[model samples]
Target chain A: MTVPAEAARRRIVDLFLSSEERLLQRWTQLSGASPGELRDLYQALRTALSSEDGDFADVRGLLAELSRARVRQGHTPSDTARLVFSLKEALYEVAEADGGPEALRGFVWFSRLVDDLGLYTFESYTAAREKIIIDQTEQLLELSTPVVKLWEGIVAVPLVGTLDSARTQVVMEKLLQTLVDTGSEHAVIDITGVPAVDTQVAQHLLKTVVAARLMGAECVISGIRPQIAHTIVTLGIEFGDIVTKASLADALSYALSRSGVEITGAARTRVAVRAERA
Target chain B: MERVPILKLGDILIVSIQIDLDDQSVLALQEDLADMVVSSGARGVIIDITAVEIVDSFIGRMFSTIAAMTRMLDAETVVVGMRPAVAITLVELGLSLGGVRTALNLEKGVAMLEHVRGAAG
Candidate 1:
């Protein structure tokens, strides 16, 4: 620890104590941190400066914790970083008290330390936010690929969003496991919620369908909108004898028939009544 | 010699693989299955693999080979009750086991062979 002169230490401490209220108010306004939080953070910083270690570990640790809390509280990275840098304002007034070359060198040293701390807080804030984003993405992937039993011998997987390889693997495993558990013979994959279907998405669908076939359950892919149909044709992608339908209802009926359940009476009467009306 | 038993259930030949197949056992089974199909005059073959766990490319290829050979002997082949993990490994290993019919269980497999025979006749 490079001991600053006793006069300089007393001057810095006195300046920090006098401007404590203003510093706290500034940090709270900038980071949306409560006044109580600012007081605890300032208290830690004061102890770090006065302690024999002189490493500022306590102050850095407090700033890291504050950075994570501010990130979770929806504060922007720049705002969170400002909370650390704002403390330098009170320290700068103390640095300005000495006009000699030695005092100027000491101020520069302290400024560099504070700058590094501010940069550390910014990095921690971004890292914390990135972790939150990745966690939510994984959760959304799981939530989007749900396997539902539509009938006694049929299961349906309704997929939304872009079909990436990771998502397709999850979809395949979940659908295949459900098929085994329920002993269902047919699986209908409805992509009605998918925003757009490209060649990669088509390949993912094919891989999933082929995997399901290997597990002994036939797959029916439904929900081909007009634009997707146009894209499929334009890309010259071959689905190769796989049954496809424009809607989930058509796929359900096809699956029902494949399972030997004839949808006979009500549908037939409706058709007959429509013909009679015509 | 560890021989995988091939049981005769009426007109259908049931080959339930209860052990992990080595190269020699697999070959012997293939030769035996072909001979049995010819001697018993079975119309269908159901190879149940529910008890077996690991299926490398060799096993996967053997399945394809058996299915093809059975077809030549005027018999349909249905591989039944494949575990989910085995299926995944097979697919990841790029073995589709194409031209082989699969069923969820032995009962469905037999029923499928019957349905195929009935449709053919």
Candidate 2:
């Protein structure tokens, strides 16, 4: 196959050799270095880079093939994860060096690779890498377009998608930082916004709530859709063990209730009765 | 850069924010997003960054302002799709994001709005 565009091809050769040498050494230590495995890794690298035929599908298909090939060839799940990670780590410098969206386009293949592996292998490592890109991309725009600082009470943050360690760390930090700055006593994360539920993401949600709670701001999760609930159940993710709700409103209402704030409409009678006793 | 309205997700509206939010754009866009939120009766707002690169402090402050106003209006706001280096730089610079809500992506921000809509008034 024709080599990648001049710059990308150069990057591949420069980075791939060190990685290959390391992989060969590792393999040699693990068993005996087979020339075929070494050659296969080289081809795998080439295939991954070459798959981008000015058409996006090429790299994606290559990732799928490499994942299966890695597994069938007895490369541990972690091995494949590292392969993806190293590619990113290598490209991370490339993007930083080049500094443009064009630089980031190469990453799409890696992103697709993460999705491909995340679905097939069901590994946390792959998920974490995906979160890195997502988090970075999310951080680019000021989501606070309609920004506000609450002088008091709770403001909810709904977290969705796979909350890998990198993302979980950001989620916990940003939410707590917001609560502190706003002086809000409650920060709710409604999972109903989440399209998928896995044990890792669920735990990160739990951790976020716990972190908020530690700051004296109670965290409430709402919007547990039926499908998400089922996935949580199958995945053995236990929200019953943590503080969560079925919907964002419930979570907000729960927060309001916890803060001793009464919604004046339906609870007017109860408020009157309590006032009378007081 | 010119700003364009793309899609609506409940009270949360997505704006394809054009031009990097620098000092000048931040001033205008703050008023722009706030007015839109109020007029649209959106409980939340997301500034899509698929095209943006840099978010200087002046613009960062605008985000904080919009977030504060949205809270006053009883709505939430989320900033979506920032680059990694941008995030790192913002954090390292001891940036003042104020009380703005941040989401990982557009879909999550929209989904968060549903929770806000469903809650008891």
Candidate 3:
């Protein structure tokens, strides 16, 4: 290890092990990122710092460009998490080929962030966004779903977009996290937006709602929008007593009204909308 | 773009805009409307924006400018037929087209202008 780089690594290790309050406080300001997430960021910064070549001044410019791209795209909390995860993974892949002690040490922090902090993958980011659509549909005060509390209560989130095994797992985790955050009782997951649901998507959603119910939250599944729903039913994939609503709105209202929130005005609009569809 | 129309309902000049109502389009519309108000000698101006689905924050900030132009030209202005969804979206998107007199429909918009003039007299 080079003198200064090794010293820097030793300092980071000490700060991590000693629970340095000042170091923690300073990192808290930069991104307010989770501790493990911050560790990932630090590792990413280390990679950018180490592999950076050419003019001594060029490193700042490269980072500036990356930051601009992030800002332009409206990077959210989840976006930051996925970015750190990718950077960590990429650094480790490169480190395996190069096999330098300093680079490997940097890889260690990034890998630890993923392992210890429960950070998700890039594909998981897409899955979360797709799931957020379910959140959006639930927030709608549509006819089938009556009360305003549907947005605040336990509701089903159908998976849409790509749910590779990696992201499917993250979606399951976030669903449980959101159930806890919202304190909703029932969550139904419909897999309509998912390009297709294999055994994995079905299994992931089932596991997620079960986890929620274990936490005293009820779960529902709706938005099994037509084709996807038909496919699952045809496959004889019994969803194990998981309530299925035709749509998210239907599921949300059923969940809320059962919880004693009367959804009067919303029901009429929902019917009227359906009648108009006919 | 040239997609927006500068229509005339008798002495009332109606400036109708469409598509995303951002700063560039608003500036172009305001400039054109000002010229139309001057050359056409309009006594009233009706700005219809029912077609706009996405309005940028900067577009909302141009309202007072258009309002001031109408006043200087001695032509009263009324905005007509902004859908509730569009309004809510605009507000949520943090665009406030404040001080622009709005009505439910074109008829109500015309009525508003007449009402304002009658009150003035």
Candidate 4:
């Protein structure tokens, strides 16, 4: 590199090594980070600056770890970046006290390095946050699709939320698997919790029904709210001979009757008569 | 070349496919099934595929082809015991096997055939 820049780098490394403890103390006080967190980062920074190639790999590694910890602690991205940037202020205080033209030049070089490290921390923080979001989304997908047995020969999938291609795929796979496991001939897909039903969603529903039929089970879609029925009719989407019921109760009874279950009201009336006599 | 065995249970013919179906085997099974239906005068046919794992377009069409052949011979064909993955693959491949009937298992398949017979009578 240029001769003056090389001299400036060396002068900064010397400053870091001379008063490492005091610089770390100032960093902790300025950044409001725990002393233990700042100490490891300070040592890594010193080692990186003193190295022949000035490779800041160790400093970056330490910053990434710090970023991950701050992310877990729910700290903001700026807060994590400021922790790295504050080290520059601590170093500047030392450089100013050890004043020389070379120290001033060295402070400029160090400031640029810290700026790069600060941005690196920000990048690491964002990456960690993205991982958390992806993990939560996967969990939510699993949680939302549940296949429950409604009767001896029937099962129901109570679907909630907006139906997307990915979520529909999960629901389809899970429903089909449950059908095979339960050997239930009837499945009622209850979409009461679904907010909307566009053509794409209707298509997914049709595919699921077709898949289940291929597995030798009949699917009855329930929870067709008034608005969704209007939308479906407006879109000219024909549910084609597949049964659509207005409520889960209707869907369940439809499934039961299809399976040859005769639900008589005699038992309910008997209980009602006993209550009246008492 | 492995041959899929076709068993006669009363008036119903049962073909349980337990082997991976290559083109040759599939074609052989189709020919053998058609012959058995005609010779035995079976009223119904149940093709059980619970033990089968994969089905491509050829094997899928083989199902429809067999169903149509049996129907022409005055026998009803009901495919039964299809695995979920296989069913989903068939659907995604756009081979719904529309003309053929399906039941969840062997018992259900037999029950469905009886129900159809009872209704027809």
Candidate 5:
């Protein structure tokens, strides 16, 4: 609320009122923003400078919206900030043209206000960018862990990428929920897409299996690559009695057999006769 | 202290815990379940905890103790209808409820007991 001397305020307001159009035009050209966007900011800045308390709330609000829009448009933070700083240059030209020590002094106070506003715009831009990144990360977490129903009374979680505690928690919750929803007695955790299997990852897997067992569902871990098997043996990580298979296909057949599903091959000659008739 | 009721369905003894399990009720229920299993000669015991929202380490241990006790009495114990949150909490607490069978619901629990008894017979 530092009302830079009454005389300086009056001088700036008078200059703004007399040449508002010219100042806005110059600001648009320098900032490379549309005239429509510059017009709202110009009016708010003029009102703020002329007000008794010298409040810049309206100006800051406009800048925040501008920065958020610029962030969505993929503009850099500095680029959004430069739009506000360029106004100082536009106003300086008008103040210098008016001529006199008073106008020059008033320009200094105006430049300080614009500096604060420019920094405010930079902060807003970064805040908006951070919000976008957080939303995307949440979406990726949900996208990565999907509980798919492989067959009647059978569910599978195809885990991909590195297994972290947070991702494992999501997978565990989703798998358990699906088990209850479908009333499936068996779940197969397919880790074919998982890159590595460290002790921590093994611990998470064991915890998940234990949790599912507590809920009365059997879990079969599949897709153990040769190198992962060696690492697991070297690490002395015991999967205990929990069944594991080398591939997803092996796991599926195992689950089917355990569920009492007899998968007999269809007659090939009957299929060929049907195809020939078609 | 509220005593947990045990309903006998043929050879299987069903105990559905619908209230918050304090220490006193848990101990009383364990004693009662043991006595019922002996007197009734139930072949299977199913403890349904679908309504239980919270469980401490003590309550978690009760499950293991009950399973062991029932087994000693010539009965198989199946903890059924355990809420997902309770299951996760028990796992986090490192109480795997080992040696105790579990099923998704009451119908499944009965089916599992039948399957076990049939296999054993």
Candidate 6:
């Protein structure tokens, strides 16, 4: 270490260790660390400063731990960075009191070191937050793609939101698995929950239908509102031989009819109407 | 040599494949099924594969071939009770068993075959 840096480091540590109450007060005012945590943080900071060139593994390791800790504690980037910058205030007080010609250069080097540490903490905080967001998105995709058994020979998947490739894969897998497990020949893909049907969404639906056919199951796509039907026609997207319905009820009825199961409810209604006429 | 049994139920030919069908067995079953359809004058063919866990490209092709041959002989083929994993694997393998009808279970498969026969007559 340089002569001035070593001297400045020792003086900074003394100021930090001697006036522990004042440092703790400043830390508490800036963030949410308890007295016990402030003690460990200050102790680690002291050890980090004594290390050569501030590029030591100990310093890097401590900054990473602190960054993650700050994120978990719901601390903002500025709040976490402020934790490191606060130490500089303490160092500056001691540096000014020293009143030596080299004190200025030493304080400047110390300030630069603190700035680097503060930025590192901020970087780690953002990275942790991004990972959290990605995990939540995966969970949401799983929740949205649900396979439901509609009848003895029919199962249905009601898809909602955007149908990205990853979500489509999940939907296809779940739908196909239910088809096999239930031994259902017909699968109704109810896209009523789906807000819009773009070309890409149509393509995903087509791929899923083809995959179901490969499993020896017939796929019926349902929930085509007027707008979606128009969009599909305007885009000139052909669903080929796949059966599509305007509603889940229509698809279910089609599936039931294909399976040759008669809905007695309709027959009863007709019989009741005939009885009333008689 | 392993063999998958082909049983006759009324005018319907029921082939319940309880074992994992190898290439030889699959071929034998196909030949036996085609012969049975012609000799018995069956109206419908139901191949129940409820125990089947895998359907590779070869088995997939065999299914389509059987359906086509039976249809040629004036009999409808319905494959039933395919497990989800097998379906997924078949789909991923890019095998869409066209011209082959499927039902969820033995009862449904039989019902589907009978329905087609009923519709035709």
The numbered model that scores best in lDDT is 4
For model 3, the DockQ equals 0.01
TM-score of chain A of 1: 0.78
Q: List residue ranges in candidate 4 displaced over 4 A.
A: A2-4, A50-58, A107-109, A160-165, A265-278, B1-20, B36-43, B51-54, B118-121
Off by over 4 Å in 5: A1-6, A50-57, A99-102, A160-165, A234-236, A262-278, B1-5, B35-41
- Winner by TM-score between candidate 3 and candidate 1: 1
The 10-residue segment of model 5 chain B with minimum total lDDT is B89-98
Let me know the TM-score candidate 1 reaches against the reference structure. Answer: 0.75
- Best-to-worst order by lDDT is 4, 5, 1, 6, 2, 3
Please give the range of 10 consecutive residues that has the lowest summed lDDT in model 5 chain A. Answer: A269-278
- List of chain B TM-scores, one per candidate: 0.98, 0.81, 0.84, 0.96, 0.96, 0.96
Error of 6 at A14 (Å): 5.0
Candidate 6 chain A, which ten residues in sequence have the lowest lDDT sum? A269-278
Interface RMSD to the true structure, each candidate: 1.2, 10.3, 18.5, 0.8, 0.8, 2.8
What are the lDDT figures for the candidates, one per model? 0.81, 0.58, 0.58, 0.88, 0.87, 0.77
TM-score of chain A of each: 0.78, 0.43, 0.41, 0.88, 0.84, 0.81
The collision pairs in model 5 are none
Per-residue C-alpha lDDT of model 5 across residues B1-121, encoded as one tens digit per residue: 8999999999999999999888999999999999999999899999998888987888888989999999999899998888777888888887877788899988889888888888999
Encode model 6's per-residue lDDT on A1-278: one tens digit a residue.
88767776566555656666776776665555566766776667666655566444666677778788878878888887887787777656655776664665666776887798788888888988888899998898878878888877788988887677778777877887777676777999998877777787777678778767755678898987788888888999887898988899899888887766655556437522111111
Candidate 1 Cα misplacement greater than 4 A, ranges:
A1-35, A43-61, A98-103, A159-169, A192-195, A266-278, B1-56, B69-76, B83-93, B114-121
Tens-place lDDT per residue, model 1, A1-32, is: 35555444555555566667766776566656
In candidate 4, position A210 carries an lDDT of 89
CA lDDT of A165 in candidate 4? 80
Q: Which candidate should be chosen as best, given DockQ against the real structure? A: 4
